[model samples]
Target: MRILLHICCAPCSLTVVRTLQDMGHEVTGLYYNPNIHPVGEYLRRRDTLRQFQEQMGIKVLYKDNEYDPQIYFKEIAFREANRCFHCYRIRLERTLFIAKRGRFDAYTTSLLYSKFQKHDVIADLGRDLAGGGQVGFFYHDFREGWKEGIEQSKAMGMYRQDYCGCLYSDFERRKKLLSE
Candidate 1:
């Protein structure tokens, strides 16, 4: 099956990509992260992904758009608790739309590989986006390979982000790191 893998970042996608390929699925990396804050950070992640794609010999669908923090902030709007729900909705929705248009058999995301992310929430959003379409959502607990993913990323010299993406999460990461 051909899979449209929504790549959050090169580091997170490292193991996921390899795993998918090992399963004999053709993988195309999609970079559609409007959630990654600050223009510089977004570009950094993009560039890293480009490098990884080249090294892995994978096809890429790059959504070269500027970082729009407002889209995220406005959607979540004071509901700090449910911010991730909206974020997942926006991203997975985009992926599903592309999958429908592109006629891909299935779709998945590197976000699922992150131990820090809300796994169940992401799965819920993915299911909602699919809406019983021909395109199915592939959910794997890639968090099981978290340590190996990080290690492989380090060896590959990928840029590993500290925060989980959104501005609030970035600020929270900074605050937590500072206190520690």
Candidate 2:
């Protein structure tokens, strides 16, 4: 199966890419995260994913690297309490649209790999976006490879970020650290 994998970052994509290839699926990465806050952090993650793609000889499609935090904030501002749900919808909708245009058999995301993310919500969103079987949602519990992915990323000298993207997540991370 040809699959378009939505990559959030290099560390998260490492195992997902490997696993898909091992399972005999052709995977092309799509890097489109407008939700990552601050231009520096966004560039770092995008560059890291590019580095990994080069090293692995994987094909990837990158959206324009325009720093537009306003677009993200605008989408989630009113829905701050359910920001992630809006965030997931924005990204997944785009992924599915791309998958349909690219003629990919299915689409999945590295978001599912993070224990910090709401997996059920993402899965449901993917399913909803993939309605009518125009493209399938390739659901996999990638968190099972979480530890190994971390080790592999470290071995590769990849940049592993501490927070889920976005200013809100960064603030939450700092808050948790202070509390601890």
Candidate 3:
């Protein structure tokens, strides 16, 4: 299957892309994370993903116009408490749209690689987006290789972010630290 993998960042992409390749899927990366907040963090993730693409010899599609944080903010407007669903919705929707456009056999997301992210939410969103339509959603429990991705990314000297990449998430992360 030719897969269009939605990459959240370089570190997370490590295992997912490898796993997809190992499964005999031709993988192309799609970098479209409008949910990532703060321009600098977003740019850092994008740049690191670019480097990962170069080193891993994978083709990555960048949608700079969709990188606007405002799109994310608007998506979650007045619904900050359940922002994860909305965030995943926007990303997976975009990925499926691009998957159809690019004629990919299936689409998956590096978001599944993160222990911090809600797997059920992401999987449901992906399935809902695909809807047995022109494109298919590849669902895998990528968290199994979370440690491997961390170790390899560390070896590669990639910038691993502590937060989940949104202003609310940043605040929540800081809150946990302050409470601790």
Candidate 4:
């Protein structure tokens, strides 16, 4: 099957990409994270993904020239308590649309590879968004390979980010650090 993988960052994509390829699926990637705060951090992830694509020989479509965090904030406005839902929704919604537009057999996200991510939430959202089966939602529990992904990414010298990318997450991370 031709699958479009939503890549949040290069580190997360390591295991996700290998698993898809090993299963003999033709994989293409999409980097559409507007949730990443501070343009510098966003660029670092994007550049690392570019390097990964070249090394892994996967075709990845970048909407980097179209990065806009304000749109992201607006999408999650007044829904701070439910920010994760909105964050995952926006990125996955775009991936779903792009998959339909590109005529892909299915779509999945590397977000599933993050140990910190809400896996069940993302899976449920993906399934719900796959409505009418216009394009399939391929759900894989990529967290199983979390250790391997981290090891491989570090071995490959990828930039590993600490936070989940949203401003709220960043604040929470700093708050935890201050408490420590």
Candidate 5:
């Protein structure tokens, strides 16, 4: 099946790309993460993805939007409890739109590969997006490949980020360190 893969970063995309290809699926990667803070970090992530796509011979559809923290904060607003729901909504919504326009047989995301991310929430958003757009959400728990994915990316000398690419995550990470 032809699939539109929402690639969050190069390291996460590595396993997803290889796995989907092995399954005989035509994959096109989409990169859109406005949540990543600090323009330099965003650029680093984007460049890493570009390098990976070129080296791996993958077709990438990159949307270089401005890094607007307001979009992320506005979504969370006073309801920090449902921050992830909003985040998933934004990202998957964009993926669904791309999948519909690109005429992909289905769509999935590298976010599924994150052990830290709320996969169920992402899955729910993906399903809703697909349903609303009449597209299929290929729900693969790519977290199964997390260790191997990270190891392979490290072996390939790819930059590994410690944070989850959001200002809130960054603050939380530091807070955890301080408490520890």
Candidate 6:
């Protein structure tokens, strides 16, 4: 399968990329995250993924370089409670679009590897986005490699973020820190 994996960040992509490649699938990464707020953090994560791509000799398509937080804020402002679903939809829709254009056999995401993310929502969104499309949704519970990915990333000196790439998630992280 020629898979277009939606890479969230370097740490998350490491395991997913490796796992798919090991399964004999040709994996190309798609970096289309518009939800990562605060320009600096976004750049850091993007650059880290680029570095990883270089190290692994993988082909990665960078969808955007401009940081547009207003777009995200506007979409999720009133729907904050279900913000993740919207976020997943936006990214997955873009991925499926690119997958079709790029002639990929299937699509998947590194988000599925994150325990902090809404796995079911992402899976459903991927399936819906791929419906009636030429590319199929490749489902894999990558959470099993979470720990190994984290440790490998640390060993590789990659930048590992604490939150799920949004202002609200940043606030939630801070709240958890204060409570702990």
* Residue 21 of model 3, lDDT score: 86
Off by over 4 Å in 1: 176-180
> Candidate 5: which pairs clash?
none
lDDT (10s digit) by residue, model 6, range 1-180: 999999889899888988998899999998888899777888899899888797765899996753577767877888998999988887888889889999999999999999988898899889988887689999999999999998999999998888889888888879967888
Q: Clashing pairs in model 1?
A: none
For model 2, which pairs clash? none
Candidate order (TM-score): 4, 3, 2, 6, 1, 5
* Candidate 1 minimal-lDDT segment of 10 residues: 64-73
For each candidate, give its TM-score against the true structure.
0.93, 0.93, 0.94, 0.95, 0.92, 0.93
Candidate number with greatest lDDT: 4
Model 1, span 73-167: residue lDDT tens: 77788887888888888778888889889999999999999888889989888877887889999888888889999999999888888887878
What lDDT does model 5 reach? 0.86
Worst 10 residues of 2 by lDDT: 63-72
Instruction: Indicate the residue-level lDDT of 13 in model 4.
Output: 93
Q: Candidate 4's residue-wise lDDT over 91-166, tens digit each?
A: 9999999999999999999999998989999999999999878799999898999998899999999899989898
lDDT on C-alpha atoms for all candidate structures: 0.86, 0.89, 0.89, 0.92, 0.86, 0.88
Clashing pairs in 3: none
Answer with 3 or 4, whichever has the higher TM-score.
4
For residues 84-130, could you state the per-residue lDDT of candidate 2 as single tens digits?
Answer: 99888888888898999999999999999988899999999898889
List of clashing residue pairs for candidate 4: none
Q: What are the per-residue Cα lDDT tens digits for candidate 3 across 4-123?
A: 998989999999989888988899998998988788899999999887787876999999877888889898999988988999888888889889998988999999999888998898
